[model samples]
Target: MRLSLLDRSRTRSGYPEADALHHSVERAAHAEALGYHRFWGAEHHAVPGIASGSPAVLLAAVGARTSRIRLGSGGVMLPHHQPLVVAEQFLMLEALHPSRVDLGLGRTLGFTEQVRRALRQQTDDVDTFASDLEELRSYLRREAPVTARPVTQTVPSLFQLATGEGLVTAARLGLPAVIGGPVLHSPELGEAVAAYRRDFRASAETPQPQIIISLDLYLAETEEQARELALSEAWAMARSRETGEFSPLEPVEQIREQHWSPRTTSRIEKSLHRMIGGPAGIVVPAVERLLEITRAEELMVSTSTYDRDALAQMDAAVADLLT
Candidate 1:
């Protein structure tokens, strides 16, 4: 299976926020050396735990650091900006990096109401999103009325960050789908993917349905050690639901020192349960089962932890397992 990474530039408690971006760039270079297929940056506005608010800008920095691994957004939330402007920004990335660029678009609005207001995303109309995608594709394909310049010969591969109805939109548009969260664990996942493939309309760019399963995955010498590595992210997620702020990741020992409510404990367990973490013997079969169930073409690891060194080790281990 093709292996990729989705680095959110996660900020840790003891470090400055800027460190997260630098870490992400460093991680991209590391992944390239390890033979990863693609390295993607995520967009999260006003989130304390995530430093990257602009995938395009982060990708330019990543492109400067790495030569081979494909760079793209994991993705860019389309409702926040004009389609033409998005087209121009990625077109410039394509011009600089050539065929090493991919565009993963999402329909999500800002994280909260205030963020939405700040982004001026007033509506969540599905039709508008579909139209904007078509418009953006026109610019990328050089078929729009006005050009989005630095016009390159190839368009960046388009993917839809999808769930539920988003899968239908991807099928209609003939684009690849990247799915994660509860949908990946849901009992209906097989049916949903089968439906997506059955209804997919092929285009010259994508002749068949493609799915990329994205989720948190970590590896270590033992199951206990791997779960410890994943606990930091699980604690952060649990706290986010309670405090309404996704705070920076903390060390596992530090997390254990804090008092946890029953709800928080339950949330943390649920989060960890959703993720795949363990030694290669345990993780590989689980991952293979997922790939078999969905017929997915790629696995996008979105794992993050407070220990950067451990995280890097896990990345290398994952590369060894998949590549």
Candidate 2:
């Protein structure tokens, strides 16, 4: 299976938020050395747990640090920015990194009402996501009314970070789809993928339908160890649902010490169940099943934990398993 990574630059409770960005850069260099296919960064605005708000800027740092690994946005939320500006930022990245950049676009609005207002985004802005994507594509292909700067012969590869109706939009546009979250586990997933493939229209950049499955993955020498590793992220997710604030990851022991409400406990259990985490004996087969079902071209690992060392070890182990 082709393997890649999506680092959200998650902040740890004890660490400065700036460290998350630095960690992402260092992790990109490490992923390149490990022979991963791509190293993608995420964009999350006004989220306390996530440090990266500008994937373009973060990828610039990553590009300077790594020579070979593909760099991309895991992705850039389209509702918050104008299509032309998005094109220019990624065009600049393509100019610097040449053929190593990918533009993964999403239709998500801001995380909260305040953040939405801050970013000058409204709920209805999502209505233009498909058209905005077409405009961005035109700029990348140098076919728009106003060309994006740093024009080059090669354009960064484009992928739609999608679910539900977004999948239909991706199919209509003939772009690769990067899918994750609850939709992956839904009973309709197979039908959804089939429809995406059936409805895909050929385009200059992508002649065939492509899918990349992304999810939280954790690995360790034993199931217990792996569960412990995955708990940090699951806990944070559960807390965020309850508090409406996604805070930095905390150590397992710290999390264990805290009282968990029934809802939080249930949410954490569900989150952990959704993620693939265990020793190779377990994770490999689970991943294989997912690939067989989705027939995806790549597996984009989007795992994060409070322990950086453990996360690095997991990355190496995953590379050994997949690459």
Candidate 3:
């Protein structure tokens, strides 16, 4: 299978934001060296744990640090920005990087109500996501009634963050759908992928439908060690859902020392179990099962850990598995 990466640029509990940004660039270069297909950065706002607030800016930095590997947004939250501005930023990136940039658009709003207000975005914006996407495409293709700045080349690829609705929308627009790994585990996987394929309309850019599965993945010499590396982020996810603080990642050793209520413990365990990890013998089969079900053309792995070195090691191990 073709393997890729989506770096969240996670900031650990004691680390500064700069450290996380630097780690993202370092990870991108490392991913290139490891022969990963693409290195995507996510877009999150007002979140302490994630530093990728602007995917285009981070992608430009990553582009300067590496060559060959594709650079892109895991998704740019489409509802939060003007479609024209989004197109221009990515066009500029593509101008500098040539055919190596991707524009992955998503419809989600900000993480919190305060953030939504800060962005001057309303909940109603979600309804316009499809129209906004069409507007963005018009500018990219230079077919719109209006033009922003001059766009010299065509946008490399347009990707939609997959939902059942998103899968259908992507097909209608001739864009590839990037499905979360957890979505593939659902009983609805067959219908989702098949519908996308069957309903896809051929456009000048993409003649066929494509699906790429993005998963949280890690691998270590032992299953126990792999799970340990995954604990901090897993706990952070569970805790943030319960508390709404979205704090930075804590070390696994520190995490283990703390006690949780039964409900909290259950949340952590469920999140941890949902993650894809362990030695290759275990991960390989699970991945195969997913591919059999979803027929995804590529796998994009995302992992966030307290230790940068361990994260890189885990990345290398995943790369080795693909070979």
**lDDT of the candidates, in the order given:** 0.92, 0.91, 0.87
The predicted structure with the larger TM-score, 1 or 3, is 1
Question: Model 2: runs farther than 4 Å from truth?
Answer: none
Per-residue lDDT, model 3, residue 106, is 87
TM-score of 2: 0.98
RMSD of each: 1.1, 1.0, 1.4
Q: Worst lDDT window (10 residues) for model 1? A: 120-129
Residue-wise lDDT of candidate 3 within 1-323, one digit each (tens)? 78899998888878887889998999999999999999999999999889889999999999999989999998999988899999889989998898999999887789999998998987765388889999999998888888856565656588999875888889888898999856656788888888889999988888878889988777877778878888898888888988897878999889988888788788888877878788888889988888887788899998788888888888888898775
Return the top candidate by TM-score. Answer: 2
> Each model's number of backbone clashes?
0, 0, 0
Residue lDDT tens for model 1, 212-278: 9998897888888888999999998999888888999998999999999999999988888888988
Clashing pairs in 1: none
